[model samples]
Target: MESQQSAGSNMDNGYVSGDNEAQMLSSGAKRGGWITFFFVSATLTGLMIAGWGWLTNLIVYLIEEFNVESIDATQIANVVNGSINMIPIIGAVLADSFLGSFHVVSISSGFSLLGMVLLTLTATLSSLRPQQCETGSSFCHGPSKLQSASLYAGITMASIGLGVVRFTLATLGANQFDNPKDQGIFFNWFFFTFYAACVISSLVIVYVQDSISWGLGFGLCAAANFIGLIIFLLGNRFYRHDKPQGSPFTSLARVIVAAVQKRNILLPSESKDYYHEQDGTSKTVATTPKRSFRFLNRAALKTEGDIHSDGSIAKSRRICTVQQVEDLKTLIRIFPVWASTVFLATPIAIQTNMTVLQALAMDRHLGPNFKIPAGSIVVVVLISTAIFIALLDRFLFPTWQKLTGRSITPLQRIGIGHVFNIMSMAISALVESRRLKIAHDHHLQEQQGAIVPMLSLWLFPQLVIVGIGEAFHFPGNVSLYYQEFPVSMKSTATAMISIVVGIAFYVSTALVDLIRNVTRWLPADINDGRLDNLYWTFVVLGLLNFGYYLVCAKLYKYQNPEEEVER
Candidate 1:
């Protein structure tokens, strides 16, 4: 019966056989399809705008509003960015193991709204913040304990809310599609919309925050979060909710446990010796375990007292199905590739935080009348990424396929990203060298907070290069994980990239602290320090990491080589 349903689901083009059709019929329309795309995309746009609004300018906010030191503010921003990326794994686990994505997203959005409201209050009520300092004042008052607590609380809630919603929403949207090609397209658009929304927030909301009023800016963010939540709830009926399977981690743990318990026992010699499943009907399960991880095969070896009369496992902890063991093996096989992304992301993280600090000290005047917001400088990267994603998906990818007689593999895309990332770092080093020369020539090195004569546009080339790299890697990582991971871990798989980013940010933070303590390259007054040397360090690291990635990519054997070839 299970096999029949699985076959039927495939025949129906990925929709589960009975429940989906019944749900569609009962609603008098299809429940999950392109119809839900608009609602999801719109909600994503609103939420992303809300998230980026406060986040992009966070370092400046902490410094100017709360009287935090510049380096301290940057560290705080790094931790906040790390937290926002790190918390998604928890949300993904909850979505995959207990609550569905809809519930997780809805509840998280409400938390985000509450957080934004808190932030707005802190900005509006003078009592909630430190006393205002005079421009160029030698002495500045820091936030009181109570004020500090309030600020941190708001940041914590907002971070949790935004973090949880980011990739879980991606998984939710991807679940609407059945075909792999459609899912790939959705990932592309998902990132495109994400970066585009960030660009808007960086330009519009960051400007409002920097130029107008932080209170008004935060209020706007709160409103956007509210609207996004409402829109998501309105489309509830149209969304196809994947029921939570009890903790996948538990099954994975069982595989390890069973393997250890049966380690003394000899490996199975025949397919009949291994337990497939209770039904013994899944064609997808291999008859024999692969040779790569033969030690784990002991977990599937069916000894006495392993099975009951009804074909159910009598001792599940002591023995698992071959499918479970294989699932664990798949994760093991992909571990190296996943590890490579961490190094790839760390340089980008460092560059992201450092760029803002550089911008604050650079000449930002656009024309005679207006000065660009320091935080908004990152918009160059976002805009570049958005444009490149569209071009890659619609033009470059297809053209490559036509010319090469095969589609561009995800690993290949990631490799391209690595090359571009290295180039971006080298360019950053050269640009910083020029900026430092200008600062020295103008005799501005001794003056703290003095803007150098260098134009901020000089930073755009490196940022644009990094953005182009992101265009290749971000979706490539998502597509690779989604396609390669076990079916039970789909949400978790999409969130893997978040893990990479989260760990990268944390690592970047540590690296920055180490540099500040050990060397004079990243002084609070960067004009007096060797900022170019720091970028040179990143370039070397990027080159070494890229070489490591090449090795991993070379060794990795895709689980579905046939499917890869077909693509």
Candidate 2:
């Protein structure tokens, strides 16, 4: 039976009911539960991700120590990203079938922590087994064959651990709140908590690397995961658990079976045997050519519901139940919007790739005694942005929501933030172009031994804009994704967000390869000795992203939870 509404049941943004979701914010049981859940989840997951950045840096440093070619760094990066990318799909399936969010997250975090610990050993172990040098020969590297093999193995484990937990934690966090309508608030908190965790990791992790041992850096990451696990365990009673409704494969199979029984598709007797479910378990799950065709035909008919004016259906048979079919139809309709996510995501991807790369290219000279490390500025900017966003969300956003009347949903904020992101990139591109010209002029003057005075620090504006963009865009986009996707597919929803980044990364890789193969423009695009071509490329992409945002703003629809208005 459907539950009756109490006061505060109709939340503005549509995910949470007023009383039910309000309790999520206030009731000690619910509030403490979700707060503990999200805080630890965010911190742990952020550390896991940040650890990769730390690992990449360490690998580069290790290459220098070992006198190995830098080109080999690509191999390490591939393993990390590939492992990370695969985890969500695997974990999502697990969550949908055997394990729930908690188990998957806990298990994944354990693997992640163990991987980092092993990675830490990579450096220390290699240092202990530093290769012996011959008399006046080529430079010798550290690490034995066994030690190198162990390092690769550890990296894969760690990458997988990091990959799986993100999907688990996010979906789990969203689950803490019972009512669907309150998810808007949940999503806002979700993104903010995520960024907050990132802020802490970016700042603290840097200090760990700069001031401490490499092992300690990874150990810190492991410690964060351990803490997150402890937090979840301690507060498990407060949270609600949606037990896995059996495997999605089984569910889909049941759907197929039901459809076939209703004469929705033509299939041989053998085709029906596979989908036959005994309780929640299946004897065989085949993906044969004939079975595939039957599945498609049934799916097509099921989605195109036959409803008459009198609400009587005139069909040979119902392939799937109305509810199940509707869910599938919803997924199909949202496919185009999901496709647009890649476009919005391109600029975001630039944050780590082109922007981080550019940060390294900036002037490193920091007066006589001080030295600013490559990409340290980004850490500063991100931390600052997090602080600002916290203040904005806490003090400013609520007031805007109250005033706007039409609820300042995460989607709305995300759509609006693209403007700032585009402007940020445009400014960065223009500044980069000028900086290059200045550096060139200075270089020509210096050929005559004339000290062409220092190039004034003009990159600050671009950095500031980028920081502001990061604050607005990343959180908003994340929240928007969660808000739109169905609850049952929350893991898949978060995975969709991750996939956008994955596509962007692959796209960037492709573009770089294309440029390398086709053009000598790379050198020309650099300012002084710094890389700016890709930065400009990202800037144009950001503007194109703004157009995508406008399109999304128009096409997007919200799922309203307040049914009382119709009453």
Best by lDDT: 1
| Cα lDDT tens digits for candidate 2, 365-417 | 56875444443445545555666577666767667756864445555565656
lDDT of 1 at 179: 67
lDDT of 1 by residue, 28-55 (tens): 5555678888889899999999999999
Name the runs in model 2 displaced over 4 angstroms: 1-35, 38-86, 127-148, 180-182, 249-318, 365-368, 442-460, 523-530, 561-567
Residue 413, model 2, lDDT: 60
All candidates: TM-score: 0.96, 0.73
Model 1, which residues run further than 4 Å from truth? 1-25, 278-286
Clash count in backbone of candidate 1: 0
Candidate that scores best on TM-score: 1
Q: What is the lDDT of residue 454 in candidate 2?
A: 36
Q: How close is candidate 1 to the true structure, as a TM-score?
A: 0.96
